[model samples]
Target: MAEAAPERVYTEQEVEAYLGENLPHWKLERGWIRRTYRTHSWKSTLMVVNTVGHLAEAAWHHPDITASYAWVEVRLATHSAKGITDKDFALARKIEDVVCWQPGREGGPLEGTPAGDPRFAYIKYDKT
Candidate 1:
């Protein structure tokens, strides 16, 4: 029997739908699924850093990470391809599952907030 190929590349619209239905922790932003984690302190932050590093290594898909005393921001983007891919979303979902969130999860200072960026909106698609 022939092996089935993995669906790796997806249009931005498709990715938006996928993220909306399957991954609530992810948000479509700047062509990437952005998620942030808050830690108790610097030590906890380091722990998450190492854990994230290992996860990224295992997936063989790296993410842009910003860490500080109380938080770590994880951004997924396929820069080389200039858009999001299955690898990026897969890794984002995995990271979300691993990280524990509190009541106010998104309050932590975002490292690089893209203010008023138009690229994050759902891209128009042609169904016909």
Candidate 2:
């Protein structure tokens, strides 16, 4: 079997450019790309953590996560490559897509959590 090639490590400038164009909510800090998701409560925070954990496990690229009663922060870096890489960006994109999805806005069957009802509220979706 052939070994895979080394992943390319992105420079600070490159990371910044990608974040600006594709991931406006994510930022570069201390060689890691980070994003903080605000949730409605502790239950929502755990949901976010578990969602991210599943995604990271499936992708085989993990991130450092911090969670409080109302927020979850995810930080990604390529530890093996010693810097940010494509994997970090890819995982970040997937996380953002799943976490920020609002089915109600798409006119789909899933009405999404009722924003007005605190009982069903989960993530605090950012207004466009």
Candidate 1, residues 19-113: lDDT per residue as tens digits?
A: 88877656778767776676557776787888889999999889989988877878888776677887887788777656543323466664332
- Number of the top candidate by lDDT? 2
lDDT of 2 by residue, 1-128 (tens): 99999999999999999999999999999989999999999999999999999999999999999999999999999999999999999999999999999999999789888778989989988776
- Which residue pairs clash within candidate 1? none
Best candidate, TM-score-wise? Answer: 2
Worst 10 residues of 2 by lDDT: 108-117
Task: Report lDDT per candidate.
Answer: 0.70, 0.96
If candidate 2 were superposed on the true structure by all CA atoms, what would the RMSD be? 0.8
lDDT of 2 at 115: 71
